[model samples]
Target chain A: MSPRLFRSRPARVVPAVIVAIVILAIAAALGWVAIAAIATGGSGDSALSSGFSGFASLGAMTWGAPPVITAAVIIALLGLILLVIGISPGAKRNIGYRTEAPEHIERFEVILPTSALASLAAAAADSVDGVSSVRAASNASSTIVTFSTPVRDNDGIRRDVDAAVTQRFASIAFNRTPTVKVRVQRRQA
Target chain B: MRRMAAGANRTGLIIVGLISLGAGFAALAISFGLAATAAPGLSPDAQLQPIAAVFALPFSAGIALVAALILAMIGVRWLAVQVPRKDSAKPLRMQEDSRSGVTTVTANVVAAAVEDDLEATPEVVDAQAILRGTARRPELILHVDVDERADFDTVVADIAERVACNCSQALGVPLSAVGVEIGIARSRQRRQRSVQL
Candidate 1:
């Protein structure tokens, strides 16, 4: 079993695969059409040539037709989706860290996944006294801790949660320390 | 795989997307009668004599060439995908003999041994290791799930120290980097449930 499983970015890969498939299909279709046209001595009445004539006749298509409008909308939507994916800022999975040892030591880096960070945050939050339950979510910039309590004194609970989370973050020498946000809410009975 | 796919295909996708978008918008505008200029080349009803006149031997040859190139490009991309990623690190050099040839150990084998040893530890419920990079400068990525009651820091530091020593001493390949990902093991009581009709 390999521990170093490479993470995939669906935002980029899915659209790319779609585009590739579309290109391949078009190329194949055009190739077949070309072959048919050549075999039929460039006859306009040939099946392949007639089929392509439909595409070549697209300019004369009326905007009032249901099918044409639908196609235009679909095509435009697909393009918009692709454009959004291309422009969006991609999320990186690993956290960078530099190892410190003796002088003249070899330089190497370590990466921790966001899942690990979330687990650490959860563990830290769970240990707090008034926190009856804790749910932690972490991203590149911050970790948000949502805790509930049966009793009042939200301020006290918040202070404790902040201290615990801060201490946990301080303990680990992370390359990028995410800001911890604690939300103390009343627990449901 | 997602990372690999994106790295290989993102640029081509953007280009194709842009073209599709532009063509789609152009079609919509033309159909709506917004543009004043006539789309002569697009309509089959037009006098396609000029374009059709050029579609003789040279057009056939060019289209055939383009079709072949497209298929070839797709084939190459497919072939490149078939090659597995470089997962296993460089082989550890063991015994070098005059007659029996050189004996080497694979990184996966060492990783497996380390995983097994770590799993045997009291604090660790499960463990996995992946070795990557050259043997001279290898990286060890460890995923260790600790017992719920176990101290997180203690378990992590213990696993790191032990794995480093074991790999260095046994395989004679000091790790250039070690990444430890700690997870809390789920309780067995919660997992085991009885159902009755």
Candidate 2:
């Protein structure tokens, strides 16, 4: 379940589905209109035969003027309603894909076995194209692998350097993965 | 499941929503029939029709609207639901984040995996392994080159397996954290092979 879905309000769908179900209910009423007329003729021949019997009774309004038309409308509406209800759960499930840990791991660290791997990682990283200089001796835990590439293109250069380092180190095990920070040392375009 | 349906509370709200939806529809049907029947001579003011009468009630349609909204909410209800359960929980997760934090997962996984690798082969004389990961960058690990006489492929396979296992264990952590870096390469002469007899 995606935590993001919770952030979005689901209130918007109801109006649309309700309007749709109502329209469906209305169509359903139309589908049953002929049958309603017939059934009403059979049961309430005195009513429609009497030509739009002018609201003669509350029971007409309470249940339905011609009963079966009401039944038709109700049945169709109920079916549509059930569909909307049934689909709602499935819809939410469809767009949901992310999960967040409730406990929230704020910070953690792992010590590396040696600085040699870090240096090699730095060396291999510096060798990549577009890189201007490697801040191998920075006090920072991450390598400030500066790039000669343009600022706008620094992202691409950084990715390339990162990829190169990843490939170079693919066959070995290290305690920390070098984070290549791309700073544009110089740029032409 | 029943408990889940009600926001992990009693199923009161959902039931209420269900009943209200039904009632609202029933009311709508009745109102439609009344209006359709009274269509001929209904007051020209257009407000006298029973459908109009029902709509005037305000609360009923609102209830139906509420029911409809509730029904819509079901679309995300499952995802929004925070159930404390796991059916197919994998022991490892390899989520890569471009930060030093990812390095920790890589390290843990790589370290744990080294043991697994050692268990598989006989000639690995206490190999040392390193691993690290970052989101802004790809992961890296240093396998401290060891046992000059050992088969390379076997060593590689052992380290890879260890990295993969640790990667899975560290959900959201990358396998690249396990870099087989040879921090020290000392040729320790083979001690007397302990006879297991």
Candidate number of the best DockQ:
1
Cα deviation of A118, candidate 2, in Å: 18
Error of 1 at B119 (Å): 3.3
Compose the digit string of candidate 1's lDDT tens values, residues A1-189.
433344423336555655666666666767776666656555433433332455444434445455665787788778777766776647875565444432211333345566666766777787777778878887766889888888775798788888888888776667778899988779764
Cα lDDT, model 2, residue A176: 38
Model 1: per-residue lDDT, tens digit, B50-102?
A: 43443443455345547756765774574355333646677766775537777
Candidate 2 lDDT, tens digit per residue, B1-197? 00122222123223434554666564554445544564543322223245434422323333344444554455334334434321211222334564535332334454456455544555455543333334322233333344434434455554455544444344443332233323323434323332445
Which regions of candidate 1 deviate over 4 angstroms?
Answer: A1-11, A14-46, A49-77, A87-89, A101-105, A129-132, A185-187, B1-4, B25-86, B90-100, B120-123, B146-160, B181-197
Worst 10 residues of 1 chain A by lDDT: A101-110
Best by TM-score: 1
Q: Write the per-residue lDDT of candidate 2 for residues A33-108, one digit (tens) a residue.
A: 3233335445322222122233244323433344534555665565555545444532111111112211112211
- The residue-level lDDT of candidate 1 at A79 comes to 79
RMSD of 2: 21.8
